[model samples]
Target: MVTKVVLNGVAIQAEEFEEEVIRQNGVPLHKIRFAFKVRSNEYHDIATLLYEKTFDVSVPEKDLNFRGTIQNYSTSVTNLYKENEVADYRLELVETN
Candidate 1:
């Protein structure tokens, strides 16, 4: 089981994680979905990092690494801009072809 995942150069502890293989037009791709928390103070940096939509993904516990694109993303709170607020974030990524 993957307990942590690295995006770009930032490492985040996973609250929930899932990995699977999916075939698209006979090509197998690696897809991962995970959940984690984001704090108000860290929101700006995270947003900036994700703005590119693609980054290096690494799961050290599984010895896996790849370049991936964001397929889906969501956050539980809209008020993360407030000081001291924390929000739950869910992200999905798929390996680039």
Candidate 2:
């Protein structure tokens, strides 16, 4: 139930957050999914950050930090180039091995 997530040093207010530990070949990995909103003014910065693919992910409430890559991503609005627009974004990140 993490309420905030820090990605590459940028703090994001998460509307929803979920974390899971999954084992692959008996090795544990952290996977997190979170949702947030992006305003028109923030679209550029958020897009640039996500486009980087990999991140230093942090969840203070969970005391979690890891170098992760994007596992899934989605946005509610595709046309966020205009002013006064807001988009809902969902992202999933998995810890790098």
In order, candidate lDDTs are 0.89, 0.93
Give the Cα error of residue 2 in candidate 1, in Å: 7.2
lDDT (10s digit) by residue, model 1, range 1-97: 3388999989988877999988888888889999988999989888888798998999999787989999999999866789999999999999998
List all candidate RMSDs to the true structure.
1.4, 1.2
The 10-residue segment of model 1 with minimum total lDDT is: 1-10
Candidate 2, residues 1-97, lDDT tens digits: the string is 3388999999999978989998878889999998999999999999999999999999998899999999999999987899999999999999999
| Clashing residue pairs for model 1 | none
Clash numbers, per candidate: 0, 0
